[model samples]
Target: MFPPKLATATLFPLTLGLIAHFTIAQATLFIDSEHLPQAKQYDYIVVGAGPGGSVVASRLSQDPNINVLLLEAGPSDEGLLDIQVPYLAFDLEPNTVYDWNYTTTSQPGLGGRNILYPRGRVLGGSTSINLMVWTRSSRDDFDRYAMVSGDDGWSWNAIEPYYRKIEHVVPPVDHHNTTDEIDIGIHGTRGPVNITTANAPYPIDPHVNATSQELGNQYPYNRDMNSGNPLGIGWTQGTYGNGVRSSASSSYIHPFTSRPNLDVLVNATVTRVLRTGHDVETGLPIFSGVEVAQSKTSSVFAINAIKEVILSAGAINTPQLLLLSGIGSSSPLAALGINQTVDLPAVGQRLVDHLVVANQFAMAAPEDDLFEAIRRNETLFNELLVEWERNKQGVMTNGPANHIGWLRVPEDEQGWKEGEDPSSGPTSPHYEFLFAPGFASTVAGTPVPPTGYFMTIFTVLVSPSSSGSVTLASSSPFDPPIIDPAFLNTTFDTQVMRAAIRSAARFVSAHAWDGFVTGQAASFADVNLNSDEQVDAWVRSQASTIWHPTGTASMGRCEDKDSVVDPDLRVRGTKGLRVVDASVLPFIPAAHPQAVVYAFAERAADLIKLGRHLC
Candidate 1:
């Protein structure tokens, strides 16, 4: 096994280059069963090589005695150039090779239209295709999660160290070594994930400043969101080293690829968990590992987990796996003709995803339209690609929305105080406004603006009240689940979204945008902004997902009837089975969940190592 990561977070440019350069070379970390011994048992079997599973496998394999077998449903994250570039996340999202390409079941709230829901299908999972924004939920949310899970280990204080342990903060290029917008002590010197500022933060940071000024300090600005208070305008921090995307496969797995005990298998699609026996005491079904198949028609192979079978297949697939394995609610299992081993009715309930809406504003400076130059003109893009390949610098290395603003739903407009900001202070932002410069009109059916220079403010609901579910579409494990995150199902959620859109509209109208913004897009202008009802209607027609889904296989206190997993991440009625992904998050944090998932997996590794869930 490899030694612990060096105690220093400081890395010279040469060290950084070596790490990014050889990321794909570590694909040797994966081994097909064809080359393996006949022995099918391993000390620990981690399902999925996403952020959570990657961390667990790497850490558990640290002890040479512990053999870790990580199974990935997709191909290895080798030679995927889009997965390496920070900005290319947009390009990767629509591709089936990198994303699961799941869609919601026609939402009644969203004008009964089915929205495309992308999940990572490759080795690094969603991290390989995600926009790479890095930040955790509010501190209050973690504390609340602890309360719901009945475990102090789920508390912010309990998980903060893990956050620090897994983080290695890198400053933006030319910004020096100083923490630009990050708070002191709130970051780490050494951990697997690389957090750094984009080389170019979209050229519209001045607009962020002007918008904040127009707000008259009523909302003020947040200096650093990662430090517990995320309410304010700040430069977005991406999970990157210079410009190369720092995926879990790259950060956690690649760093320890030489570890003999850690074996990863790619292109192994798991069908379900296996139950070979039952616990003698509680009579809970004992997990015997999992069944894998090369394809839907391939012969099944059962791999035994000598110790435990941990599901890190993310929120969507984890619950599906449990239900398919006869470890879920009796009613659903009966319908599918699958015998129920566990009556956990809450396995696929309470699903949540961030509902986002975008407003397009016309930018007068046609010459300043960045997308036209890079997106349409292959010559310009090629030049930028050359710069990125050479030094990992330039606009090609920039994540889409670099200047982000976290705001609470302020209670004010036209001498009116709505008093509707429900979240706890600035530390817990309720809304997110992502500034995308030269990002007007839809290009290729995405939210991108038309083929010209236009600025856009994508308003997002960070803490939504509405919830949905992931249910079986059929009895077959190969069939996709019915995802119904019933976006804006509740009236309160609708009100919050209305407030968010209006607030974004106000920011666009700020005098600061006067010189650049000529007018609102005709699509937005067609709406009746004068009436609150029309604004709500407009939002209902246009809202889409921000791609953060959680809370399906939620962790909860014993009293919670809908809870599927306990605070220990073990299913309610099973032994030797645990979930270690976003599925276990009792509630979606105020920020993105990628960081939270990494941190929780660290705590999970410690808990498992210490035998916290011993039978």
Candidate 2:
């Protein structure tokens, strides 16, 4: 076990150094509303300290002459053990104070279920609470963005460097050499966010790898999925180092808090983007100002940005803020008594999210079921927690999944509408599978069995055909927006999910798992796997989100009527305001979106710095 003192000793100097630096630099790191100067104007005002805002604010403030202010609606991420621990990620959502705790409207496709949607509300945003999976998706995913926006900057060739710029590969907690596990040449050694593989090996790791080899080409063994070709079973990479979560706040904001030009304000919510004036030639409204308040009833504060106001409030809140500011469809704003600021009707449309369904199977080797053992035995769980706190090595250092697989539906099997292929290209995945060595339930309120050991295969529809929206529930900024991800709404999405479930079954049916493998768990025992109707019904009943939401404020050509933002990520029919987050993705990448968001923000910072010259 690592000595507890060693961890403290390592952090103490860093803390002290930050304090000393702040004292010498005389720079304010955090500011409350009462201390904020009313007359001062900032060069840039970034709303929401998520991956997008954090990178943008940090990169922009690199220029010593630029002053940046970042506003977050939630509390600080420091000292939150739940946010820092990778294994504790599951405890931070679904009505936690650190989460937005929003729920989707009832959906017909989900058997009239209202899914619990959790978005991070802290300094690091969702990166602090997410499962920590780091996937950049496929190369074609970026090329499609370039093709749709008519800008080569978003292509894989142009954006690949940003991925290297955003990641810093670190050793896992166990300190084992990862030469064969991942491709070090493809990752960055000197970057802000730290990425690593699972620390201690799980008992099922060998079985999974063996199955990959036994199952032939369809389940090919991928040495590193993050190498722009994510098409097979490979080790899962995460944004964590030394058993500690490396969130956006920790990577981008916390390290540079002592910079004199940057100021981060927690518990300060920007209610609306205040329009300052109209452009002399284009007649576009200038949204260089923002209305902020500590609470819904607190005193409203008006702040101006001399350069721009960047919105990084995730997919849900970005559109909500725009709609509240009268920048959405004019018809709805008129009914809500809000004067029209922009006639763009696509602000809250095109919301896309990955839907997950868990297929659990009983495991014959109960002794090797680490996750089930921990859940059943409190003493074992406490001992493991102590082990992690002491030496940062144990099950606590990893998330639920140890490996992930991205696969495309066979070309002949694709059941999409004619000429309506949703995937970016041939390399893009139609669905994904996360292999968890324990019962992994995406749906809330599902009870774990008391005695039996189990493993789960999480089937995720990456290229979803069904789209939804984020619209105003009320005119008040305090009200939560009505979100409708519309999971499994289309026959195409349902067919893809059914295929994923069948593929997962075939994966575990390999000769390598003859002894250890058991039949399906009780939850899915009755479902006829051979029947498409029964399989689709089971999927609809069990489907929930992986929490990778995007495309609410999608980027496209300026003349595209359905696009909310242009290729530069500027809001249509508006000036001096832009969006830099997952919300700007026209389509959700065929993997987790955190890594993509980081790269996007890195590129966005360069574009914003280049200004009109690039636009």
Question: Candidate 1, which segments miss by more than 4 Å at Cα?
Answer: 1-27, 175-180, 214-216, 412-426, 440-452
Task: Give residue 151's error in model 1 in angstroms.
Answer: 1.8
Measured on C-alpha atoms, candidate 2 has an lDDT of 0.86
lDDT of 2 by residue, 246-284 (tens): 999999998898887888898888889999999999887
Return the top candidate by TM-score: 2
Pairs clashing within candidate 2: 2-391
> Stretches of candidate 2 above 4 Å error?
1-31, 37-39, 613-615
